[model samples]
Target: MITYVYLVCKSLSLLFSSSALDTSIITYDQTHLKTPRFPLTDLELASLYENWLVGHGKTYNAAGEKERRFEIFKDNLRFIEEHNSVNRSYKVGLNRFADLTNEEYRSMFLSGTMKRVKLNRMPGRNNSNRYVVRVGETLPKRVDWRERGAVNSVKDQGQCGKSICVFMCLFVSFIFLLVEGINQIVTGNLVSLSEQELVDCDRSWNKGCNGGNVDYGFRFIINNGGIDTEKDYPYRGVDGTCDQNRRNRRVVSIDGYEDVPANDENSLKKAVANQPVSVAIESSGRDFQLYQSGVFTGSCGTSLDHAVVVVGYGSENGIDYWIVRNSWGPNWGEK
Candidate 1:
């Protein structure tokens, strides 16, 4: 026997406006009712639970804690199943982050270490030193550095507070590949830069593992000649010695970096069109933690806590969004 679940809540419309949850926008035929799968046996649930625990690297200090975490994991799995049953435009599923509470998820994956960038008004430009725009020029509809093979694969920060370093490394790597004329079709010779090198060595005004700023990282890159490749200085998720011998493995260098005017999306768009721009945004909200695929129309503030890279931007289903490259691994969102 098949069972169907219908979501008819009015609040759901407001909660997921981008999803077009309102019946007015979606006709009766457009609404999809998912058929329920066969219920798992107790033995099956136990096996799945063990696999999930191992897959997510979950652990407990005591028997009581383990029991509590197991219940939480089961609840999360049920939530995923129910959420998937709804007639939403996007899909949601269980991943490494499924079992975590909202706070735990934010602290582990979404926590950022970005420092506010002080912008200086240029004499002849529109506040920014690098980005210049004409009065009535047509901007591209979409610009993805990933499509052009300039951007690297999404990396996982893995509980380390080195988001700032990861953002800096990704932005610099994109710029380096762009300058080198490497494209999607010809990426065999492209090199991935090391974020661990910055984490270990660049300690002028930034703290390793704890937190840091991208502005200081950019300065370090310029002064230290260049950054080493990831193969030469692998990330250990902790701070270590800056290998003097491996300093010769520098693969990418940047003279400097410019920040777009604060809270100015237009200036940021221009910057991203040229290259992947290092950016910081509020990422500690529940909606952000639960974000699946689709344009993120969630309640994101302008606190600027976590650092990320804006690789591209475009409008989807009339909702405009910045294509942010996160450091929370590929399993967390649209990889």
Candidate 2:
């Protein structure tokens, strides 16, 4: 039950949206967080909870006793929440879990894997940076004196009868409120994106993942020391010479090949129409290659002068690849 609640709270935003809710978007800057920003109906929250966990890796475990397991799992969830929100240095205490019944949720707090841990040394900086000074010292407070505690207060320690659930609900609710407030204050419009779009936005924001050369168009924006072809061939220029010249740089993508001779066999356009928007067409060297593989992993063309994400994918000659979307114009590269 605790696991269900945790999952529900996490997945609620994925299931449904009002126009206001749908418009909510989470940007991926390191300073920006990615939590649901709106309230969800019970059913919508439940559906998202069930599907996302199943999709990710928190499935039911079969190795442990049914009754003893959920408590441990719930403890794990509590630990993670506390670690992220309250305890910084604490490693996540629970990973493995078994399927549990509702009775397990009620009766499983027995063998005590769930106790509040008072951390002496805080791990990293919390969202805030002001340090409390003592007398004339300039250093921040020592870990031993920082005085942080879990949500469980004194009255909570000796509680009984639905007390645990009440505390659990309160803790989760507080996190929801905090995250939503942060989202409303900092995140941009997300309603314009569907699930797949959200995923793409995240990928694009990954700094290390931009592994290919920058196209001349993109280079204009980031060509710090002019073109370093050895390290910068695979990328497309974004805010470069063209933009400065008051001309829209020619954008190259599978979308512009309307008059090009398509094999009618494997085509990038077909890939996009079929798969999730996460698939895309990528350019290989000066040539074109289809990048139809699904999200997370797919092959870009070899010896790639530049690499771009395929927002969609399909097949040609039974060869599967992606339909890459690039910032470069139609005249920039191959069809």
Candidate 3:
């Protein structure tokens, strides 16, 4: 069963017209570019058996299930090969989402229920502060919190619609480490914060395993003093009893978080230059779903249905982009 709801909104401003002229090309080292390997036709049969045995290709003992998965894998491979065949600004390939159809893929993987809260804007303030690049204020061409050792490995949210919880956990955890200084992260003393604790325990205004706002989650952290590490309150995906014993394992507290003024890409860049920042952007487009690697100058909409983290920003082949860290898992993008 597959379902989809097409959202009609403003087209992404990423794909630039010839009239737009401020962007510069940014290049990456060839060695760092990851080209995903898809299953070859010659080895498909053998790979299918291996995958089935490992509980991947099939579920029920029903006939034709294996064949269905194989066909799906071939479709995925064809999509990748076709997209990469010609030179493009970005690359696309088979990841964990390879086998699912567009509808199934969106339903299972991109189910973050983001509430559209209208932010109150102050009168006369431009949507954002004017862009002023300070003297000697150059940022790195690229920055990944994972490389800085402040971010944990990419986490799979599974079938749970709790991406809000996951992003909240990632945001708070990384910010805590950033405030504690790089020494703790370098010394391996930083703890992986618990998303499950937020899932099960954050009852102020959040629904466990359903979805919630990041601001509410942050307020929960502030009122509760802190949140537990992943070791103390492991992720169960589904809602569970909030373990009171694990509450004492809190390691960091959130004072508060400020929202970047709406549609302010410049402010977003500066915020990310300092630390990873949680962001919600429209990701229901097929182009976003198939994103494999490189800077994603999107064909995305402005509906803002999903939450992601902006780890850095840079240009690729004259297109400026945000280096987004997704929660779909390490297999989904450049990990």
Candidate 4:
């Protein structure tokens, strides 16, 4: 059965939203994530491609396009098989994104804000530079806000270039959680905020479906008085004009946001130990596209291209991982 996750609640307001992880579209054998691999013949390749298409419930509009996608799928299959044939910590498998070329994949899924970024002082941003961890303090071995019922749900950006499901999709959900977490810390109430509100109205810098800056989103919230609830605005996965009435129904609000020191894992851990933090990472590698499971300490690049949330952190048999709240939907990860 397939389940749809509408988390961009439309996609991103600052960062790129998930374009594939319907996480409705999950696959790869349980064995695939941690099992052995072997070579496949031409006949095997043809058969596998057919099965993948059927299983994913996919159809191309034209025969030529289908053929093109098949070739792309074949190339991706070779990469997955080659990587998995080796004994490695992580494995790759055929997911919904298999037919897409890397360039096509990045264009559709990765937000532009994550690329070619030039950092500057964000106007009206909170100026605090430190997370304030005491000298004697030590982080716990693991922290998972999902286990503690702090996370809301997984989201899928579909084909969104960004999320409220417009330009940058993941931030639509992450920022919602970030503020919700903070609100819970203060009011002890959990409310789902509307990502659509940001998508439609925050046009000063955000591009809706083209991508936008993540940092600018917080200030937009403060200046707008507050944000609306998801029920109030709802996600449409496409661009729409801002609704004047619903746009003003601010259900949740924040005082301001602070930035974490760059290249500082300790400070990051300290922050994650306390609450879910918005973050970006380089997710352009083909391996990242087909990742099945196991800690994703990857073969990806340093070029930041995607945005996600660090809800918590933990260590497992010496392997440490951040509990990332990706907008790829529930089916994509640890459901």
Candidate 5:
């Protein structure tokens, strides 16, 4: 009877425990229990990737402009933080911008505030009109709204007159921002090329105040991976890496000049392929040039002993600098 009573008590205890568990516990389906991966648009993903490499609180110059520190846009901050590798020791670098082309950037920019406008020549009686060229929806583009003036008829002007007028009024400020963005893209904010500095380089005989530095200023980055180099005149490298036309060939190490135009036909074009352009403070007699004869295009710099392409150029505080292109990934240099 005692044993039977003990068994009854144990059964009661067991029943009570089961009842308590059922009341306190909550059940979730597999679909509900699993955490869903956050979906980021391409822009968000790119920004996140850039932030992860550039740094959480880092700031960069917008081209070569001063008095401005471009902040890392916050389109996808939270999502980036989740995927950022905690084990990595280095930050994202600016080099990623070097290999990026204007077309590729345009795709990203299209997602942002890029705008297009039609322009024409003023009927100089000798020159004709040019078609529509998309302008970035930003200050600099608006500021220097008339840099390469392409005239339009009153009717063709459409409703953009008021907006165009506004941009024309703020040309200087917009130019400064444009240069700043270019500089940021080039040097990764490690260096800045200021407007004043560019002017100084243009005016001074020694360029960078005798430093032998010439500013290329900021330009719109263009993408060109799809084009066949050999088939194309300007872009003639095997992988469309560099221009081919003798006239369009980039002048590597303008042996004795500064601010040489990319399309300068007078400039000696390199006939050889894969020639690296070298940076020399004094135009050192080094064979390795920083810019390749037909390997790549765009502004770049290099040392006599070590030649590298000037993927980007900018100015800072009345000084100019170059953004060298490298094959390394984001963590390797400027992100």
Candidate 6:
């Protein structure tokens, strides 16, 4: 579910996802720009895989796992080679996820209660957006909250758990804390809020590590009188016993959250321009998994399975693009 809110300001209804332009917004559809490429020989593939293993410092704990991963690595290597070989708007490269098959990647990151629990259980499809642009509302040609010291540093949700919703929801809250300058985030003093607070404490309509909802997490923070700082509560990745003492050390809070009107790109920009907006997206496609850099003119699906923050939007080389703040650490995304 795509959720929106601000540090006591306006919020847009666009789902977790793009661009600066004339008042009228143009939604971009994914285009497949594949090029046939020669495959690497088995010997060459093995060599590259060995080099990748050394660079990434990877080792399999169990027998047969290394060999099993090797095949998947080769396929991903071919994909990266093919994508980089072509003249596409965006590019693909091997990342920390290079060794996992596309199915494994999606199931681990995109499945479970973190994403859509069931099609019928999806939230806010019929809800109205909170922010709407006037016919002649003026917007900046570009909006980057990072430059304004609103967005926090990139982070990685270790593979110990599947609480992506926890990371994304807290990330948005962190940004709002920054934007509101709550405790000096705007003065070059950044803070990492505790995602584990929501992961462990917020059990209403959410599971701890298996999966969770961003909206429900926010409500937990609000009712709890705000969340604890990461320094106090910290993230353990896995679900653990809730520490009420740490949970009571409230740090920041938001009044409420709203949904960005589904499929409304225009309203999304408005929300992002005012303040970073949390978005839900379908990040299960293979193309998205290997995305390296450049503007992502997506051919990805619309399953709304993953969440991220849209920090800003602008036009690049005449093509408008959104700057998404992903939680896969600094190694991933077009940051």
How many residue pairs clash in each candidate at the backbone level?
Answer: 0, 48, 1, 33, 48, 7
In model 3, the runs with Cα more than 4 Å from the true position are 1-63, 118-142, 159-189
Residue-wise C-alpha lDDT for candidate 1, range 1-335, written one tens digit per residue? 10001111111111111223222211011123123343766776676667656655678787698777767666766665665556554444455565677667655554454444563442211344555556795678887666776655534555444544444443333333333333323544556667677777877755766565555666676777877877778756567787877765667766545556665566666877877666556667654555445444445565656555666677666556666665556445555
RMSD of 4: 6.4
lDDT of 5 at 219: 18
Show model 2 residue runs off by greater than 4 Å.
1-305, 333-335
Q: Write the residue-wise lDDT of candidate 5 on 1-335 in tens digits.
A: 00000000110100000001111111112211112235646665455444433442244456642112112222223322332223221111121222233343323211222121111231211211121122542211111111122111011111112322221112211223333333343444422222222222222222222212212221111111111111223211011122223223221111111222232211201200111122212111111111111111122222221112322222222322232322212222221
Residue 182, candidate 5: Cα error in Å is 14
Residue 285 lDDT in model 2? 14
Candidate 2 residue-wise lDDT, 81-147, digit = tens: 3433432111221112112232343243211223322322323212221222235543211111001
Task: Score residue 47 of candidate 5 by CA lDDT.
Answer: 51
State candidate 3's TM-score. 0.70
**Tens-digit lDDT track of model 6 for 1-335:** 11111110122221112121111111111221223235656775676667667756789999899999988987887777766666766656665578888888776555423443342334323245556778898878888776777666544554445445444443334443333433333345656787667777877756776555555665676677887788888767677798989988987765555666666678877877777767656577676776655666655445566666777777656666666666664334443
Most lDDT-accurate candidate: 4
Pitting candidate 1 against candidate 2, the one with the higher lDDT is: 1
Model 2: lDDT of residue 313: 32
Least accurate 10 contiguous residues by lDDT in model 4: 6-15
- Candidates in order have lDDT scores of 0.54, 0.23, 0.53, 0.64, 0.21, 0.59
Each prediction's TM-score versus the true structure: 0.71, 0.16, 0.70, 0.81, 0.17, 0.76
lDDT against true structure, model 3: 0.53
Find the candidate with the highest TM-score and give its number: 4
In model 2, what is the error at residue 241, expressed in angstroms? 18
